[model samples]
Target: MHSSTDTGPDDAVGVGAAVMLVEDDRRVRTAVAAFLRAKGFRVAEYDDGETARRAVLDAMPDVLVLDRMLPGLSGDDLLRDIRTRSDVPVIMLTALGASGHRIDGLELGADDYLAKPFALRELQLRIAKLLRHRASRQSPLAPFTVGRFRIDPSLRRITCDGADVVLSGREYELLLFLLKNPDRVVSRDEMLREVWGWNSGDASTVTVHVRRLREKIEPNPREPEYLRTEWGAGYRFTPSGRSS
Candidate 1:
């Protein structure tokens, strides 16, 4: 519904953050775009997923607000396609507020999800939080050594035994957090808040990410060396592996 050239004022905290909003509903899209623009976010609005997808592939935005249901392409499929190429943070918006739907979105690599009939302020807050977390991760820092693995936050890269290890954005963030708090048991609740920037959500999201991280970083995911579960407590990161 809106052109890619549309931009807001350059003075707010979200001055440089562009939000690509993909929603088929005219009423919802218009209202949401107005609020975001008022808040000083440059917005590129689309009513169909195909156009939105192409736009993002051409030039990824700082964040994406996607609707689960859309014409041309469904949000779920679009999300899957994006995961293979970009790590731009995504927030799913839909009338489907069921827990299963939320879980599916998270599993598909969405950074956040908000049900319809939600507060506009909450959406803005969520976007702000995600951007802040992203900025913090890019802060200059020395490479961290954890056993045979080395993590460079600035470059957003990780290596194991000097070999490159691929990781998703969320996985990288989780690993970085665990590495920073080595030797301590970090509860799932704490992880949700600190690592995911989520005040509350399903604990399984943390579990899923941890499992994926261990698979890539550990010799065996079944019996992880660096990433260990604390059973009733949560998870513990052994910087020096099991030998430590």
Candidate 2:
């Protein structure tokens, strides 16, 4: 094994953050990525929303830069699909003619919108602002309290009855996802696509994350108090003292 340290910037494209750009045009992709990277970010480029979606799960970008017109999956469809699960920040880039598309993207779930033929500097600024805003908004809920546990997203810290608990990023994402949607039965596929963006069979990964989340957040760990399993479907987040 080898010891390591961060090679990326303090706010790496997504060290604790990332900006995912999904554009079909290579020119735009290169230009945008270079601009973002120049700004001290960890940037991931995708050609379309489908791939972007997968990357989003895998990389967990802090913000998504989505082009309105895509090849296989339309940007609108991707936005709608994303809304059903995660609330990762999204910014839509559309052609000037597609003004209606811009409005439509925001209606679905996009946090911000921009028209094409845009300035690289402006886009970089937009993504930066969104990421900063998202981070700020997250803290109040990061170390959220259930019955006895607290989830800390920043440090990936967890505490139960004031005792220290550690959680992996995947576990933190899955558990935080569920906690935000308390009392709901989240399906495995949804968790996969949203938490880690697994398009295929990754049930085991989901299981592992959930189990880890339970071990840290659950009071009994044997009989989980927060993360609950649904035999055939998936899992649920039960705020403490809630009955199954």
Candidate 3:
């Protein structure tokens, strides 16, 4: 469920991002969520991974703060599943001194990892940094080529092999965002903010758009080329349509 409450100060950077927090511990979850809300983010908190897994597919938050030891699906399993279809920037929290856990999380496509007993401020700063990093990769206003797909942001158009490929408003926006971050894994959170102007919403909107986009650009949507899913990460726009 999505709960909207204001916390912190209005002076916090008003990026209006939404954060989904998955933690089994009530105390830790409550404290961290309070801090995030204060930082001017909309937060949806979950106590277990099973419920979160279902909710995330429908209502994908901009960022996910996941704990490794979760009930039901477990953090690592949930992360692995999310990476299959959606690229939502995930920051995983593991036990202190568990180097193996940290390594496993990263290998599973976690954007960042944190040990328990860390400062909330540090988590805040990490989230801000991740958001900034994603923003920094915004594509300039220009036409670009990714494989046979020719994109004209100025014209809001795409063409494959000289044939026009029509896209809906959302489709156009999604494609543009991907093209801008070429060869990089773009989480669903970044897509929602940049393309939909939403701090939080159904992530299936993104999943649908991606499928439609692949239909138009890829030679075969079932076996995609230009738009590929990075397991444990997110979607990537491979410019050459060929894996390097």
lDDT winner among the candidates? 1
Residue-level lDDT tens digits of model 3 in 1-244? 1223433432354258989999999989999998787777888999999999999879887788999999889999998888766666678987753666666775565667788888887687667766664554444567878766788766767787788976644466677677768888988777877765546655555666677778878888999888998776778898678855
Task: Between candidates 1 and 2, name the one with more favorable lDDT.
Answer: 1
Query: Model 3 segments beyond 4 Å from truth?
Result: 1-11, 140-244
30: Cα error in model 1, Å:
1.1
Task: Put down candidate 1 lDDT per residue, 147-223, tens digits, no spaces.
Answer: 76798877888887789988778887888888889889999999999987788888878877887787888888998
Backbone Cα, N, C clashes tallied per candidate = 0, 7, 5
What's the ranking of the predictions by TM-score, best on top? Answer: 1, 3, 2
| Per-residue lDDT of 73 in model 2 | 93
- How do the residues 1-244 of candidate 2 rate in per-residue lDDT, one tens digit apiece? 1112323332343333567788999988888887667667777788977887776666566777888899999888987777656667788888853645555664565656777788776566556555654554356543567666677766656666788765433445566677677888889998766654434443655665566566666658788766778889788777663655
Model 3 weakest 10-residue run by lDDT: 1-10
Candidate 2: stretches off by over 4 Å = 1-16, 97-99, 141-244
Please identify which of the two predictions, 1 or 3, would achieve the higher lDDT against the true structure.
1
As for TM-score, the candidate ahead, 1 or 2, is 1
* Predictions in order: lDDT: 0.84, 0.67, 0.75
> Which of candidates 2 and 3 reaches a greater TM-score?
3
Candidate 1 ranges beyond 4 A from true positions: 1-12
